[model samples]
Target: MNGKTSVVKHRFDIKLARSMFGAISFGMALTTSAFAFDPLLTHGAIPMSPAAPLFANTGSGVCVFDSMPTPLTLNEAIERALCNNPKTREAWAQVKIRAAEVGIGRAAYLPTVSAQWRGVRDETTTNVTNYPQYSSNYRNSVLRTESVTLNWVLYDFGGRAAALQNANSLLEAAQASQEAALDDAFGAVSKDFYSAQGARGAVDAQKEIVAAAQQTFDAAKARADKGVAPISDQLQAQTTLAQAQLDETKAEGELATAIGTLNGDMGMEPNTALAMPPVDAGVKPDAMFQETVDALIETAKASYPSIRAAQSQLDAAQAKVRQTRAEGLPKLQFVAEYSHNNQPTTLAVGIPQFPATGHEWYLGLQVTIPIFEGFVRNYQIREAHAQADYQHEVLREAQIKVASDVWSAYQTLQTATASLVSNEALIEISRKSYEVSGHRYEKGVGNILELLSGLQAYARARVSWIRAVNEWRSARLQLAAKIGRIPSR
Candidate 1:
């Protein structure tokens, strides 16, 4: 019985030794598998840090007061508009986009390089007829292929050249459009600036008139109270005072409206307080009419954005016609490629082998001739020609419009100048009449009605003079704009 027990223990020791060896082998296999798939060692993954900040100071912590007055000149206001106005910024961005398009078109003339990578894993099984039974064998295969190809356009029958030219012309057109927008914005700013200034002047003039009317009313009231003048005179004085108050209110409203418009144009909040810089209003109509017109036409021809934009459109359309016609011809290109390939195979059972590696290189010229496309190319060329014609018509129309605008501005300027001169003389005469009538009424030599009539005439003359000055200034600005001169900044 002791010997039987000893034999059983020996058998158990051998089985336990086998189990321990199997577990160690299994653990080693797992470690090998983990190493094979470790991305940190095999794939070399890179850890990336966060991006840095774009702005050093965001200005978010600054607080600005609403009542802080800034003395903004016309030039300063224009600069602000360019910097802050949404419309101008959008237009500027469009210019950049058009410029990039031109670059893209030009890139067509350059060669293109590209790479291709492909991997495949395939399995296969076969049946043998001699055994009359299916025999399955497991095989794992992987194929990785990479290639680099270069394609360059040798010639396109001038298609690429014409397209490049069209792109350049379109870029010019976009630039002109930007310039036109800038000019429009500047013109608007100038108009509003001058209008605001004129409104301010009108307010001052009306205040002066009000003061004069108040003085006359006080004198009439004093005389009526002393029993030297009739109660009707007192009533007339009160009416005059009421009219002056109404005039003052209207003038104040005009000033407020002008301020609002100017602030809005400057890209500021409507209620924001603005202080206007002083401008020199001593500009004289010194140049002769003929000289001015000649200079204006020359300036318009050189700098007018509309004319430049139209010319650019014409150029682009002409280029497009050439491009479309070239599409009917053959296109020539040069293509080249280089590649390396390796294939591994299993020759027999439990035997693995790798085949010889190979390298390939080739270059060739390819030509593509457009034989027929159901007359699509023909129609395209015809359409381009029509568009070219349309562009020409548009240019002609722009010329006519420019001429008409110049002529109208000239006429208006002449009329305004004459009116201003006449209004100045009338104001002088009315001021004399008012002074003489006021003195005579105080001495009881003239009637209150007569004095009031004189005052009314003087007020009318002053308002007319102010209106004339504003009209003349407006006409001059219009002439300056027509001539493509930048308004006074």
Candidate 2:
């Protein structure tokens, strides 16, 4: 019987150890998981701007880039800017922050569980002073306690719901603001790209003028050597060639400056080397520009990211008002706790110490009502209402400003388009007149002054034509931005 009893006790001990091990393992798993989860993991569930992930960082503070392209296109430039620029990243970070807030809001609907464990060594020293013959007594014991508690807010009179809605609205607003930042970056990079292209075109045009001047100088020198033209003609032609060379040099410098600006816009060092393909000859204004200004303004009002952000802000503020009002009401909560303790008892001076263990469980409903707090709740509600009203005006102002921007951009585009047409004609006419004057001077039928005048006119016309082209391109992009769209590459 003793042997059988020993076997049963050993088996029971093994079972008890296994149960404790399983419980500890489960608790450890839960703890590890709680720490391992990140708020960024919730981004997928939140509303995210499409532009937020363009050329996203691959790792912490690590943006990957292979090599710069030799002949980069406009789209490539835009991508590079988006990838490397900090403005869009800042906006994207705001989206993440707001997303975390949304997680906090959703978590309010769930219960919080906490576990606690404690151990203590207790010691006591006692002396019977009233009886002179009594001796001192010393005692020591070990105590342990373990507890698990759960608290859940069952009701808050709509405060939690309103707060969650506010968070969700702000998250949406953050996403829209991110999109607006991206649009700004896109517009800026495109403008720089076009400006660089125009500068390059000016340099090429200057080079062409220089070549023409050189040819004229050579002709006049040859005529002067043969005694057909006077030395004055050769002198004048040489001066013209020198002026053209100086202008070409200036144009080259301007081109360099433009390239540096474009590189900076792409988030590169200003002195970084950059190569870009020439603007396409087939490129033209977008067909969308054909719509009336009124129609365009209406479309912009409906879709502009700024307008969307404002609308969402208004929603968030309204929700805030609701939350503030609910703060004055009562809250209801459910509370529960389970606890166990192992303690030794020594009640009297001569009493022997005895081991004791106790288990306790509690369940209760908690109600909290806010009566008054120096009228703070009332003021908070008023502040929230004021903020909501302010947001409403902000939304209206955003719409009005977007419409005005569309109108201004539309007018600028119209003017640029008309100027482009006239400049095209002017360049052609000037080119023909310059050619005729050059031929006449070569044949000794026109004076050096006449030829120089025609050459200067042609140069001016070429410069004007280039400016007109760039203006038209820029105007189109501006209008597209106002309409909350990326300019077509």
lDDT of 1 by residue, 1-489 (tens): 111111111111123456568777987997999645542231221111000010113243212224434555555655455444565556556565666667667678889998765545434444344432333343445555669999999898899889988987887776676666666666666667667766776777788888888998899999999999998998997798789779888977987898898878767887877765433353544543446666677668776877888899999999999999998899999999998766555564324344556678899998999898999998999999999999999988877777777778878888989998998999999999999999999889999888888888988888787777767766776776666664442
Q: Give the alpha-carbon lDDT of every model.
A: 0.70, 0.81
> TM-score of the candidate numbered 2?
0.87
- Report the number of the highest-TM-score candidate: 2
For model 2, state the Cα shift of residue 39 in Å.
Answer: 9.6
Score residue 266 of candidate 1 by CA lDDT.
68
Candidate 2 residue-wise lDDT, 216-260, digit = tens: 889889999999988998899899999999998998898899899
Span of ten consecutive residues with least summed lDDT in model 2: 4-13
Model 1 residue 167 lDDT score = 80
